[model samples]
Target: MWTVAGEIMGLWSRDIPEPNEVTFTTMIGALAQTDQFKEALELFRLMLRKRVPVDSVSLSSILGVCAKGERDIGLCHGLSCNAQGKQIHTMSIKLGFDRDLHLSNSLLDMYAKIGDMDSAEMVFVNLNQHSNVSWNIMIAGYGNRCNSEKAAEYLHRMQCDGYEPDDVTYINMLTACVKSGDVRIGRLIFDCMPSPNLASWNAILSVYNQIADHREAIELFRKMQFQCQHPDRTTLAIILSSCAELRLLEVGKEVHAAAQKFGFYDDVYVASSLINMYSKCGKMELCEHVFSKLPELDIVCWNSMLTGFSINALEQDALSLFKQMRSLGFFPSEFSFATIVSSCAKISSLFQGQLFHAQIIKDGFLDDIFVGSSLIEMYCKCGHVHGARCFFDLMPGKNTVTWNEMIHGYAQNGDGRSALCLYSDMISYGEKPDDITFVAVLTACSHSSLVDEGLEIFNAMLPKFGVVPKLDHYTSIIDCLSRAGRFHEVEVFLDTMPCKDDAVVWEVVLSSCRIHANVTLAKRAAEELYRLDPQNSASYVLLANTYSSLGRWDDARVVRDMMSDKKVLKYPGYSRSVCKNDTQMILENKQ
Candidate 1:
């Protein structure tokens, strides 16, 4: 159709000695509509060179073309189009069309779209009259820049100027809220709307999802249903994600039914989300059923299935599916490589992991941060810390996760000095240590018996690094002290720790006490654990074992009687090993 239109315009230019303003206007508008932006601008310039009087319609059409072209080229190369738009603006004022509301609004839109909000504001301030569109353009401009405060100010001004915000206004405000992650403000804005459209509902739902408030997202989804608002593809996908996060299988199945009813079950995003929801719920059969039923699968759906297998400890199956995916002509994305590499790590398949690493290098994803981090973790988990360090050093760029993985690799391999040195380098390189970094470092210190160094690091966590210690950090420090036979210090530290009531804290303390033969502290730790987590049999067993090891038969028997009275039966321990032929064998302790 565009080619036909261009041929006719060519014939007209050849046949007619001079095309009138209407002729040029019609041609330029047609080109702009078809996304022939360069052709549209060339024709507009031709009209000027022909000494033809450019009308308001022609100017508005050209401005629209410039705005769209600038946006298409992105902000980096938008200056040229911005220069042309300003020239058009100057020409509009000279032609006495500056006061024309439509022309003025077009100029405003062009400025805003080009990211020249200051010029947009200038054009807006000079306008004699304002429409809802004018106000919306300004609000949306600020919203796009993530300046939510300015958008709110304009929204208030629009209301004060006797222009009730339409659906567009509210939706734009919600978009700002989504960008800024202000759920409270987003909900207030949604509630203030007399009648929110489906887009509005989706916007607020996204806001809740962005901050990981999945429960609220689900609750809002229910409210949306009660209001009789039909769920679209996006609505279903968002709700499914919330269900996946909470592992709400029953709720997820209901959403699956809703998707079928709405005829959105085959939508790619919705299908992938269904796979993910089932996978997270530990329903591998249901996950497989969803995957097999998909008639057409995109990379996202395949990645979802691979992730399911990895999370369910079916690493061999995941690898087989990966091979099948490639054989079927689906190009693996970075996420695909990351998932399979993680699976290899889970099963300690160093040979396969190295093969994947070679493939990652060949496929040019070696620079990808996620893939790099996963490779590091895989090497570390497969008992190859040096291999992990080699990859860590070769990477051109590194984020906090990359740094943490290498440090954790060293820590897990019992190289405390190397982990601490890498941690110092991380700080020197300006990467802030998060809670996980501290856990790895403290664990390294505990395993190496660096008691004084561990104490110094723990004490500096709050004042120096601004990271308030959590339960895991406190537990790591306690274990470090307990390993060094500093029971007095451990007791004092436990008394002062904020998470003293947590079962995990007491459990660690009890385990350490039993190892160090502090029967009195072990008893106290056992009682705390019993109060915190009554169903756990480890506490009772650990306490009884402590008594037995110390030649106190009466105390051990008493503890065993208490356990029997409480009906806390200890389950037999078991070990799993993968055979050479890729099968699992479980060995249960009979004694």
Candidate 2:
């Protein structure tokens, strides 16, 4: 097809009769559709060279190709200027073609698409009569680039002047609302819809979904259906997202069935969402079935399947699928690498994690914050805390999550001093710590027995930074005091806990009491622990040990007898067998 188009050009220049504007317009349209925009531009240049009079018909055709913004609009603008610069307004000087509205609209659209609003306004203001098509393009230009305030102003003014908005204008406004997160303003626009079409319904639905109001999203879908407006691909996609968030497997299944009902299962977008929904809800078998039915795959489809496998803890499968993507000639995107790095974290295989890390560097995505964060987490979880630190330092930019990862990595590796040092550095550099940062910092203080430091940091959190303490912060404080053997202090603090005691909090106090051999406090902590974790045998066993260590033999025997009656078997202890130089096998008692 390309060769024939090339041959047509060869004949046109040699001996063919002068081609009319329609011929040039038709050929350019075909070339643009075939993605040969450069060749089409060359043909337009040839016409200009031969002194063939160019009309708005030919000008608009070339402008249409620029509308995609794939071509250099600057060069297009230059050509438009050369053809009609200051001397001839092609839209006004049309001779053979009856005032070409389509071409004139395309010219206005090209200027807007390139963000050359000065030229666009010039064209717009010069229009002999305005049409909804041209007006819609200008409104969309503002919205497409996230100029919401300007879009709203222009849209409102356009409406006040008696120009009724079409479906395109409403979609633009709805998109603006979704991004701006003005749900109230979005609702106002929704009510103002003269006649809401399927696209408008889907737009409103997307706004609700983005803000995470799943119930509202679904309710809108139900309303749309009850109004007899059939759901399209976009509607099904939105419904699938709502189902994923709610984890309502039944609703997800219903949506999948609806997709098949409307032959939308073949849509790569909707099908991908279905796979994601099933996988997120923990139905791997159903996810696999949906994934296998997809006829073709884009990056989105591949990412969905890869993420599904990752979420299901199928590490080997996820890696294999990623390799398959490359072997099938699909370029792995940043999301693909991030997903594989996460899988490596779960499997705790440093070799695989490094392999993916090297691939990320090769792809130039190693600097991407998402990929960098994943690499740091993978290295930390795999016992390569130093390697994780190295990557964190090498990252070009760091978000709050990146800083939190480093802090948590230090705490998990028992480098409490280093964690505290990093926290100080983070503050010195003016990076405000979030709640997760406080958790890591407090944990570090707890591990290092720095009670005074922990208290200082905790107190400063609410007053100095306005970050109120969460359950994690409270737990960290309790754990720090207990690890320091301040059992009485822990008990006093527990009495003042604003939130009810959870298993972890009670476990903290109980563990400290057992360490200090405080019989009365141990008994109380045990009761609280048992209330939180009813089936916990360790709580009962620890309480009995507390009694035995205190020389209360009768009370200890009674606790043991109760355990026997309840079939709460105590864990047996065994010593390890080791060779002189190398390791040896030993059969330890099974708890």
Candidate 3:
């Protein structure tokens, strides 16, 4: 079709001495329809250069092309397209076509698609007439920008103006909810639909997935099927993602079969999703099979397989695949670099991590937050806190994760003062700390025996930072007090915890009791741990050791007898090391 259009365009240009308004408008619309946007723009310019009379139809067609072309080229080039659109708008006003309904609507759509909502609103408000297209464009534009409030306001205004909400309006509203993560509002919008279509189902399912409510997404998908709505490629892909998050391999397989049945198995996105689902389920063999069977591979497919290898502890395999990808001239995305860097961190391959860091810098991904965060983690895990700090300081932007990594890195390296100072700086910089930030700071206090400081931070968590203390925060505080031989404070804290029965808290107490030879507290902690984790030998061993250290041989014997009666044997400790070749070796303590 494009070839025929091109041939006809060539003939028209050569054979016609001077093309009139109708001929120019027809050719411009045809070129735009075929996605020949540059040619269409050129023809419009040629018409202007020749001083051909521009009609409302021709101007509208050119505006439509500008809107679509702006979207395709992205914001940088969209600015140029937007300027050209404004120039055309000026021409329309000069020619007395600005009041033309079709041309005014075209102006509204052009401004909206170019992300000039201010101009779009101006065009919309000044128009003497409104159409469904005008309202839908405004709603979709605001929705795309994640301004759900504005989109909802537009919806209300649209109805008040005597225009009934249609399927497209509801879908746009649902999309706004999806972007804003307003799950309840999304559900309300979806439920308000008189009869939702496949696109609507997919949009609502995405809402659930976006919030990590994978179980709800799966249930909604089941309901969708019950309503006799056949799954499309988008549906299968969203459900498969939900399945991956929940590690529901069986459900994922069902979605995979559905994709095949619907003849969407070959679609690049669906195939990539299958690989991701299998990879996340720890089914690397299946992931490999699906990847190998793909007739053609896009960048997404390659990245999925690389992530699968990294997650499955196949760091060497991931590195090999990454090398192969680069060899094949497949440009690595930020995700690809981040994944490989993470694999390097897991295996403690500092040399390989440094190589990848250089590659990331060379590829100009050094500024990407994800890649920068990964580099920080890799350096920290490789026992290079200085290197991590260098990257952290050089980062032009830092999110909560980036700060958390650097603080945790310092905490792990026993630089508690530095970690706490960084946390203070984070606060002063106006970066809102999350739960993970508290955990990192608390852990720093624990390692440095700053029990008072740790407790103060924990107390201020909800009030100052609006961060609710989770189990890890509690664990860190407990560890901090216990390490300082403050058993009374530990007891008081444990009693105040909502999850007092949690075995991890008792384990921390018991370990500290063993260290300080507090036989009574050791007994209490051991009993709780025994009840919570039966057949585990750690609690029994710790209690017996504490008793024996205080010369209570009889009590120690009794505890050993209890362990023997329960038939619980202590497992040997092990240490892991990574070789230069990226192979992991586990050394077990025979003692």
lDDT accuracy of residue 117 in candidate 3: 95
Candidate 1 clash figure, as a count: 0
Ranking under lDDT, best-scoring first? 1, 3, 2
Q: Which stretches of candidate 2 lie over 4 Å from their true place?
A: 1-165, 188-195, 323-331, 361-364, 463-466, 487-498, 518-591
Candidate 2, residues 1-591: lDDT per residue as tens digits? 465446776787686567766777788888878867666766666666666677776776776666653443334434543333212335335453324667657766776666666777787776777788877877777666667777788788788878988888888887777777767777788889877999889889988888899989988888887888889988998989999989989988988887898888778999889989998899988987887888887999899989999988787789889989999999989999889899988767677888888888888898788888889888988779999998888888998889998888888878888998999989998999999999999998898888989988998998998898988898999899988888777777788878655877777777777777878778887888767776778888888888887898899898788778877766676665432112223233445
Per-prediction TM-score to the true structure, in the order listed: 0.87, 0.69, 0.79
Provide the lDDT at 506 for model 1: 79
Query: Best candidate per lDDT, number?
Result: 1
CA lDDT, every model vs. true structure: 0.89, 0.79, 0.88
> Which candidate would rank higher by lDDT, 1 or 3?
1
Model 3: C-alpha RMSD to truth?
A: 5.4
Residues 228-337 of candidate 1: C-alpha lDDT, one tens digit per residue: 99999999999999999999999999999999998986787898999999999999899888888888999999999999999888888899999999999999999999
Q: lDDT for model 3, please.
A: 0.88
- Among the numbered candidates, top TM-score falls to 1
